[model samples]
Target: MVKRRDVRNRLLRLFVGVLLIAACSAQAAEMGGKSDARILIDISGSMKQNDPQNLRRPALRMLVGLLPEDARAGVWTFGQYVNMLIPLGQVDAAWKNKARAEAGNIASPGQFTNIEDVIKRSIADWEGSATLYQRHLILLTDGMVDISKNTKKNAASRQYILEQLLPKLQSHDAQVHTIALSERADHELMRTLSRETGGWYEQVNDAEHLQRVFLRIFEKVGRPDTVPLKDNKFLVDSSIQEVTLLVFRKESAEPTQVITPSGTQFDAKSAPQNVSWHRDIGYDLLTISHPETGEWRIQAAMDPDNRVIVVTDLKMRSSQLPSRFVLGEVLPVTVSFTNQGKQITRKDFLDVVNLKSCHTDSNGTGEARPIFDDGQDGDKAAGDGEFTLQVGQGLAAGKVELVILAQGKTFQREQRQLFELADPIPMQVTSTDEGETKVRVQPDAELVDLESLEIKAALVSQAGEEQPVMLLPSAEAGVLETSIATQELLGDWTLSISATGQTRSGTELDLTLDPVRVRGTATPPADPPEEVVEKTPEVQEPAVEPATMQAPLADEPATEEDNSTFQVALFGGINLLLIILVVLAIWIMRRRKQEPEFQLVEEDDQLVEEATAK
Candidate 1:
């Protein structure tokens, strides 16, 4: 009974093991999902030598045996050149047969190595046979270029081949897988090339591990993930390297056949070969290989004038964007677009992308939206369109970005522009004299190559009246000096200037005007000249005054009466003089009234006596 229990327990363990194996297999299959592992074995001369770890073991033999029977298999070998030793086929029947056929021919020592040619041919075969699905190219090299027989210089042929072929293959969208058998095999170059082409690179210390490494590679390459076109086509652009072209109908998935006028027939997977001008519809496809691993360009070119629409290239220059500018400056971003494509009257638009701190924030950082239309002749029916943009405030000063998107598939373009902003640059203009109403400005240091800078000044008076002054730089051999003179005025004036200089970044300066004051007092008119007075002479009564005065006083009663009578007689005689004097006064008054007015005469007494005697 114990023996029976032991047998049952063993059976249960075996059953569990089988179940576990089945579950693991199912899980792997689910993850891989109908993607067969496509393995590329590099059966170069180096593979023939036995590695130290796997004694008497050839790396290629071990790798071939280890590949799963369900996987797709191919063999490639290069000595003086490369050959597709095993055409891609099911691993069951022809796989072993083809592997055996290629095994003996794999090792070709003491022969030249044309790596570029071998890669080109391999790419051609893969593309021609449509074996690129789940495809990988395994490169195993022991040493460097030996293509002496193919060209005058040993490395020339490889360089020529790379120049001719890499780009063509790249444009065709070929991915690469590379392996270095030893460090001597231009490994750095190979690794770079593979990585650039979106392939993986590995270093092999011993050939014995080649088989397992390949298995891992298959596992990685077989996984299906969406590869971005931009990454794959990195080498395809002119600015990029190791890129090629694969010509195809723009709307079709299949590559177009390349037929050169020189009667050269190249597989679309070859390098981006030169074009042959012809009256017919033949074309060429080119593949460009990247300097880095697996990076390349694949592009297709056609000779058919109708299908090959060669448009003019797009060119652009904007005066508004300086090397540096302050935040929220409305620079004159002028853009000009030209048509370079064969197509005529093609309409397109220019899109401006704003940046903050040199970073693109798709949702603009500020409320200011671009007010300009996308292209020339765009609708501007609304009169207030200029006010629509909500520009952000206080953007950090640095590099700004502007992206122009080309519209209209058929159009090619070139453009340039000059622009000005309606808004003034914000700055405080303080002046020493509050009364000074005029301002002038110029570059502190003259800008050498610049023709001029656009400058504008704003003045704010003490009364709160804001005034703007615009000045164009004078065309002379010196600092750009522009002057703004104000009307005769009082009150503190603020002078601020803003400008875009050719050599200078957007700049602003401020100053204040001082108040002016007047000086000094007034005097009285001169006094009129003074009038003169005349004096009359006294009579002889002074001679008898002392003696007669006393005697007359003593006899004053009676004698004084007699004297008074005599004096009365004398005074009566004096009455005549008085009468005369009255007559003369009357005459004088009459003369004054009747005749022209004369100055009062101071007469001599003799003249008066003469006049009285008369």
Candidate 2:
């Protein structure tokens, strides 16, 4: 009888441990919960030019250190092949230490970019559809798929990644956030990955910006609860057990220091027993345990990237927002407060709370916009403990952050979401057989009223000469077209484009487009580069980007075609991810199980290796 009792106790303990592990991993997720992230970085020879100083090292370190204890993550670097740079495991002090130490080995020596392999190996153990963990894959690359020098084989592999690999990841509800580190990087491919998988995509022309980008990705993945920093100070409520200050420092600035609620000042050198300080290349990450419940001040230079995150019982719950979007997209965001695990929904107690959308655009300027619980604007229903607002009006395309700040009579809580806004228009430049350059524009019929659209186009010569063009409706119903006399033009000519349009709802639009350049054919034309006075935007092509892939938001319900594909993020909201509907998600899970499973390539020493060997 004694032996049997002991056996029963041991089994119970084992079952409890299994449950704890399951709880630690997920996808319920209200926005910004525990994280399960897989990181894929490129280390091909091209990095020698793109990241000569290896800023990826410090950037990776910052991400690893900021990961809370509940997160599960791993890092893989790919080039000639894929290598698990750091093994996937639950995040803890030991995991962080190992990850940070291994980061020093990040170097650009690989021969090719085997993006396909790295992605496969990273998520080999991930299975099932519905779960508790929000799955995210961060892919950083500066080039296209190049598994081999054979151009056809490389193209096939890239195709496989899109056709075969993407569906499998989508089936598992994984979001792939991508970073293109150089202008030469495959922006189209990265954009497709982000768009199809509900991941965020960013293009960083310079490697120096990797750390900042990584920080934003961390905000999306980790979703750390935070206290708003006002004028270099933040207030910690009684519910906050720990607070972390991530302060960016200027090269000539004094070391960052903080003053606690007790009026005690502490710097990295003189931090108290409960404080942990990690000062990195351009910023400082400091955490304090059992923080006093009061306002805290930072004695350092003020920067927008600076933040104060907390481990707290009181949380400002928010609607999940996608981290990537285009201009002309209006995003609805909602927020509420929770104490411990239950929501604080008393109208009398909540009526006095001030909820705001604090914005920082590409220019690094700050703006505060009010959100209300009055059941108007984009708010579905109001005053039921939910406050709502819609943003993306009069906002430029670039890196942005929307800080959801809620301040009540006694407590202050904030959540930060970072996103990249893509240009609404995609310009395509191609030379006609006649040596003329054609520019096409086919706006999304669903988003824009075709009749009210006006597109302006100009051909800019390398020598700074511009020739304006006129646009007219094409034969097709919703297409616009124009042709530029580029036959006589000598060097590369850049197409400068700007537009004015009105949505079907009659809202005026001002749009910006990137410069699209095509080389001259070397054949002399009837008109000289400077002499050609006129050109117009045209609709020689139906879609610069696939029309079918245009992301459909919740406000705009999808047709059967859209619903057929597993679309919509499970948790994403403001600029967030993950908002999977219960019944619909289960349906998707059933449908996904019927599709053929993707098989990873068999392991080979030359094709795969551990980073430890390097």
Candidate 3:
């Protein structure tokens, strides 16, 4: 009996354990795939004109459809302000209907693009809510921050987004994927935000491509493991280190064929000795070490959804150039390329490398091709991938992105380096009481090639009047000075200096000074012309003889007029006293009336009597 009981208990325990495991697996399967996403839509005024078709509405609706029912999402629109149209909530029929309606109603255009505020709000929302879903932010913008109007504020906004908000998003494990809707968008900033947060940046030039980009984002979020590899062809260049093909299918095993550059076919079932492959339940990973340089095609019989990834063996390295540069200065850049730990020394391969400098500013973009340095112009050696870039008169003061594109027989690679060019010469204006206005130009000795320095100055007034001023080179090494006459220092004048050398640089200074006063010549009062003292004759007043007047004594004051005056004075005094007494009496009566009547009554006469009796 004891043995039987023990067997029954063991069986029951095993059955219960099985049921618990199944329940947990089902729960995990239900919860694991759900995602949390926030969609940021740019509704700035520029978007209305730039995106004429209003493709964002449809794209947003499609995104809503793509989200699974278990997912949670929210929508926000930003301009000068940010508005949350749909708070983060579970995606259901009701939620979808409301989200779509609100998204469709976002037709009104806004004034400015306040991207930083929306990003902050999104981060706050995500941090405030605790969930197990993977977090994502889909930021789409048609215009950059409105820096033209308030540059300082806009710059601060950008800084806050990068410095303060980006880290918070990172700590929260939220990825920010950015979509640039038009050419005017700040693509560099958008790319930085996405790349730093392990997300992708997509640029959609036309409204028609909006849907496709949105779909791609959806795929990335929903089915991240699925690689779209159908009908994909990859060029395997000599620089490539390894080529990997991932085939994802529903079948247990599928035949995958890879055609090499020399028309050699390799099958997954009979892969060559050089090929490394792994087979799993529903996927296959095929890798070729040091793939040959040629066109390679991959095809799977069962799974059309596959992906080919190419890893280059080429090791490219570049250093961060000085963030600041003086205008008219030469920028020397060195790039090195290596393959499989060996430096590529082929002359033809080095010749195919091209460096493109793209300088962008508020005005526009300027591009230039830099030449390879061969032991000339500050370059120490040649053919080692050292190039010197000269920013000359044509390029304005702005940020520059240096792009290096190197192409081999079958592959091409690109790398970008960024730097900024600043005006080399510093300018200032000074004025003196002597009616002389002086303009000074100081060049950066380190960056300015003084041998080729040429400086020009002009005084521009507020009324758009410009007067050319001659620059007088100072005895100092890198100083240029110019003076303007007091007469020309009219209403606010700006001293504009244009310096040209290996590069061209210019700066403008407003010349505001106190009015110059001209001293008037004072002739001595001519010695007052020996001022003649004119004496005026004074008329003497005739002396008049004083007459004696009789005065009344104190005893003679009993006259009738005096008596009458005294009586009148006495009567007025009496009346004044009487009026004072009357006013005092009235005041006393009013005060008494305001006071409450004090009635001394016996308090609880019965109790007092009882106590007394006790």
Candidate 4:
């Protein structure tokens, strides 16, 4: 009985050992199944050119660093001879370092470039490493060749290699990714390689941009598992409003695992912005970006009730527009935020943060002042959407930076940088009447980080000449205000007020002129309103003496009054009688003239008297 029991115990022990081995083998296969990635590198002579972005080392460093930790990569330096430094193995720091160190040592300091050998050898090595299902070959080269061929040797050799190795790689189902770093690479060969092996091809000119290229390759290889709703958690914001989440696979190869919030539907045929899954291997993408200022939260898991949590809220908001202006000007910024779970306004008790004043210079004259506007003196309020900030007159005219504080429940701070406060154009303001009506010059558009500007005024008459006028600076900020006594001014005149200064870049503004108001009193003319020219009517007296009698009377003594009276009376009477006779004769002549001339002549008495006298 003891012998039989020992035999049975030995058999049972053997059975247990076999079961453990099978389990171990299965676990190992599961772990190793996902990491079979082949990376083929190009170490041609052209790589030494520093052709891309003058970045010689960083580009190579990035390409090697982005490989997956578990991925098996191969290094092939193809020049005159094929140098296979490392075979397909797990991608880790040790392997990457080894590959990088070997890359540095490729071709020594002086060696000929031979690409065909590298391609053939890389294919052979990768094919030998794993089965066709787990093979990938990537080629990196500048793809330029220089060969002194006597008998079509170079072209024939290249054709032979491509025709033989590319088809073999394709038959083994090996993926071939080619990266041509030169601007003029052999595109035909690269395309054929990519097509034959069903892989990707990229030509990168800027080495700095290669980092993104490597990242894209990693994403392609990651092949993460999907996380289902049962594996993730979802939380709805009770305080804030609407929130929507979207998830989609970037490269959907098969019907992978998908997870969503409870009661959420799934759409199989979708794009990047629409992919969502419940498993971790697939993509767990948060489609709906959290609001800039709001309280929101949502979650997804494989297990509907337990596993993962994704919560987000609008923790900050900017009421101020994302724009900049001159310094010393009022900048109003407002923000709203909320904690999804806490529902508490998060602002700790703090002292006054006196905003800086006159932060930037406008003239490059090494002049700057602290910029601040409390809105007490016509400045914008804290919550007001519109705010004004003055660019101090002394500030340089280049780029400026300012920090605006929103003294709200969140006490948020916003930074505005590189604000351009342009220089004021030269202008002249002149008022004709500088004594009565006071003329002031103000900026049409107020500038940021600026205080009062210079107002040079010159009064000019209509005859084009400058008259000096005193300019009194005002206490008002940003305004070129001055009072002028316009009553003393005479005639139409112009007050030329000009503000001239250097630009932010020290460029001179010589001819910038603004139209000035002409204000003055006019000098009245010294002429009377009306002038009368008197005309004396002729005085007529009765005709008492003829011209002969007047001549004899001239010798006789005659008193001034008597002579005047007689002459007046005689002239008046003679004038009256002659006036009556002349009037009658004019009437008769008019009547006779109205008759026929022959009849009038016949009726004339003078004709009959002359006939009788003859």
Candidate 5:
């Protein structure tokens, strides 16, 4: 009986686990496999100057409103520390309401900008590779990675993000989209993070357009199905169950007049019963449920940013291009369409459609390119829904927007990707020994014309004075050298670099690099070498010594020498006296021996006489 009960409990547990897995899988399938976003906002002190009006509050609210209901999201504000302003959870009415309420609390009251720490903390829960959801990290900042006053530590923080933190993000398939809010922001690092992670990057000079920027990023993250709008008119297919119209206003009234397929007209205030309209500072978002499958039009002051997104069975899909690229890198771009959440791979349908691509340079001049499904142009197979194009060859180095247009005799779809082409020969500045500032340009020899790379630089003082410094060819090839004069290298200076070069393919390259901040106290000038004076040698005459106090002999320090000489003389005299005494003793001994007998005989006679007298 006990064994049967245990088996029964085990079976019931297994059943419950299977059902839970199925429910989770169903939730992922509903969101089209990936829709999780992590938003990181900078609350550093610098934002006070950059975003004084605190326009980010409204911008963030707009983003929170636009996020799909099924997606999971969280918000974090980072400065010297990171705070989870909103916990990560599935987006619902409650979550959106909470986010909206907290958006007002966004302020620039925090201390240093610790980008690395915030990013690490934001992704703490993410460990493994992307599977069920496509993760997005949207970072907004107005300053560089400044956790301390030490410049080296700040540089180390930036490097740690690129070298260590970036790989972990990549491993987890987290797209890091960075928005720079000021000119002083670290654009180089911002561009690199987004470029490396295949995410969007934008620089907003004014806070006024922040809402628009957020909307653009939302489109990328949401991957919303959008129908092409031509001259304020769009055709909604039968598969579109819902349509959301985003219209920009010029005068702060109703953004636009939305006319439905059934000739029903609506605006923000006079919207139909089923239509949901939201009016914000600069734009309006109208969500229509079960829209008619026919032509629709909007009457508004024409704006390029006007858009209509749909929730439908038919969706156009494309692999996103990276946010930035090096001059020599070539990447493959692909576009396709899916119906009912599956790729439309029908050759007959694909044959009737045309997919075209063009790239617009910074000057708004677009050059057209060919895209095809034929097995020739980087496409794996012929007649597949996928269309491929190999781009980035001979393109100028700057901001370029890629536009892909697909037209199927009946419907049209379009997508745009913004990317930056970095200089092939990235320049580096280093504070060398002896106050020498060096600009090193080492591009791949095979890719760049080294001799044609011309480098120009200037030393900019704190007072904003420019002193053009010549960049001569350094000892190493492809290196440009310049020295920081002690007088000009006043503490807290900038090195401005302007370079023009050529690719091996004969393409001209013009680049304006970010000014490099060099920190050092001006070195004090070496005191003028002390003047050496030549003087005649003084002739010295010996002074006459007093009789009582004779001056010591000064020749060759003879005090010691004289003492030693006297000692030798005294020793020699004593030895001579000893020798004389010895000789005299010997002679006397011989004489005594010879004369002893005669003296003894006389003394004996005397003694005998004396003895007789006694």
Candidate 6:
């Protein structure tokens, strides 16, 4: 019975061990499955001359094809502006083919290298769509951010990258791996960006090596090692500020040793001030703060295999900056720092913060000096990490970048934010004759070659009724005329005008004209009533007619037949004269009234003339 019990106990222990191994394997596999990547290729004019072999095209194709079939990936090209050729989606064969074709068609006609813009756009694409576990951005640029003659403009570009782009990348659990294509590339900035986001930065001497580098990156992201590590040695370059080594093994009791490039050795028990170690079931973490620039070595002993991952220690946290700005408005930017997922509250890390603003345009660049917080200008507190700048005065209307630089005794970092500066819509309203309102909308003076403009007007009554007023365009340029009969809208009326249009083909603007009261001349007086006159009878005229008639009758009358004929003639003559007199009276009365003889005039002649001219 004792022998049987011992055998059963051994079997139980073996089953528990197997279960633990399976759990570790599952966790590692889950980590590998959570990555979404965005590949950004710089297609600025310099690319045409710098990359003669055109290796970037093939590099992109290979990257898309190599990414895990289930992984979500996107492709983008950047120059003066950033364009997403493909949004984040499954890496199916059909999608891969389409992406490759688009990649090949990318041209290098863009004049400037707008790196900040591209980074901003990529983050926006990933925030809502990418996998929740791991997000990655592989940025390849051959030149520095397009710097304008204005110092502020250059500073703004750098600020945007550090403040806006870097924070977004971190919050999404995204890493940005940058590749410097040539010596002219801003290697320092790229390195800082990568280190801050827990990513790698590599510099290549030629374009031919792009494909190999990209493939290596894909392997690291898509196919992380599942096999446990027995012992491993790696190199940490001078560019890396800090190093973190994660050791995963089946047994936590095993011993581990870390050796710096200087050949100095330290273990878990005797770690130095720069080194810290933590132990957990099946895993151990060794962190070397402010590590030396040379190679580092690690050795571990365990019954089962172990895995080691070396990551940079630098991390950053920051606030989102405004991306759209009106012509004359102030922009507020705030940034903070973090170490290993915890906010850094140390005074040393928060001191020595420098902020600068820059504006970039085709003509040149300009710098806006920092505005100190005096409890005004939208700043709540000084030295509180919030920075403010008033934009649009000296700044050109275009892209603006805000840069923040901060330094600690152990580490120094920089961040950048980007914004689009636009002019406010200009409108003029005037009251014209006939209660009509004339509104003139002019395209922003800073804008050139506007596409179209739409204007609408409405009269809002005190009773909350809206009466839409028609806007008619006149022959004069930039003029829109609309009339509202004051008689029709007698009560208090508020005129509201809305205008929408594109300054350029894709730059849209929607604005409302300031409300104005509809005013008009005093109402015309009512027509006066006609006066009535009494008429006196005419007595003298009757007597004169009787004297003449009596004389004429005496000369006539003798024979009966003659008298009858004479009487008939006189009566007939008198009737004929009376008929003539009545006809004449009717003619005079009709002329005085000025009525058409027999026709009706449908419209007033003056109104018809005005309508025809219009």
Highest-scoring model, TM-score = 2
What TM-score do all the candidates reach, one by one? 0.28, 0.67, 0.35, 0.32, 0.63, 0.33
Please give the lDDT score for candidate 4: 0.48
The worst-scoring run of ten residues by lDDT in candidate 3 lies at: 507-516
**Model 4 root-mean-square deviation:** 30.6
> lDDT score of model 6?
0.64
Candidate 3, residue 547: lDDT: 24
Local lDDT at 185 for model 1:
72
Q: State the lDDT of candidate 5 residue by residue for 1-614, as single tens digits.
A: 99999999999999999999998877666544558899999999889999999989889988988887768999999998999999999998799889989999999988899999989988999979876788999999999999999999999999999999999999998898889999999999998898778887899999988988998898778866677788999988777888878887755564578888788887778888779887766777778989887899999877877877778777777887666655655678888889987899987788888888877775575667768888885689888688898877656678876778777867767777777776766677666557655567556565567778776778787888777877776788766666665444557878787667776657665655667777656776789998999988988856542322233344534448788688567656666766777799899999989897998999999999999998
lDDT of 1 by residue, 1-614 (tens): 99999999999999999999898776654433222333333434554453423321234543443343445666655666566676767665358546744655544343655676676666654443223244456666656666665445766765664666655656644446667777667776665556455565677766655654554454344321111133213211122222222222343434544333233444434424343211101223232233232222333433211111111133222222322233334333433333231222222233232211112233333332333433333323333211122222333332223333222233222111111111222222223343332233444342311344455556666667767656544464332333333334344565555555443343432222222221101133579889876766856655542212322333446546686788767646656666777789899999877544332233455578889998
Expressed as tens digits, the lDDT of each residue in 318-357 for candidate 2 is 8777666657667788888888778888987788898887
Off by over 4 Å in 4: 1-33, 50-56, 85-88, 103-113, 126-133, 145-151, 222-614
> lDDT score, residue 550, model 6?
35
Q: What are the runs in model 3 whose C-alpha is more than 4 Å off? A: 1-32, 128-131, 224-614
Winner by lDDT between candidate 5 and candidate 1: 5
Q: Which stretches of candidate 2 lie over 4 Å from their true place?
A: 1-32, 362-367, 397-400, 420-441, 445-472, 475-478, 481-614
Q: Local error of candidate 4 at 151, Å?
A: 6.8
Query: What's the ranking of the predictions by TM-score, best on top?
Result: 2, 5, 3, 6, 4, 1
- For model 6, residues 1-614, the per-residue Cα lDDT tens digits are 99999999999999999998888776655554556888898888888877876778767766675564557888888888888887778887678778877877776877788888888777775554233446788999998878465768967998888888777777877778889999999998997787677576778888877765675566445642211123365555433554555554545455777887799888889899987575533445555667776556776654222322233334433444433445444445544544543555555445544444444554465654654434467667655544455444555555555444443444344444444565555556766555666666555534423446666778887888888878666677754566566665556788887766654424455656567786534466788998878777856634434213432455565669886788778767766776777788789998867667333454566678889999
Q: How badly does each model clash, as a count of residue pairs?
A: 86, 37, 3, 118, 1, 19
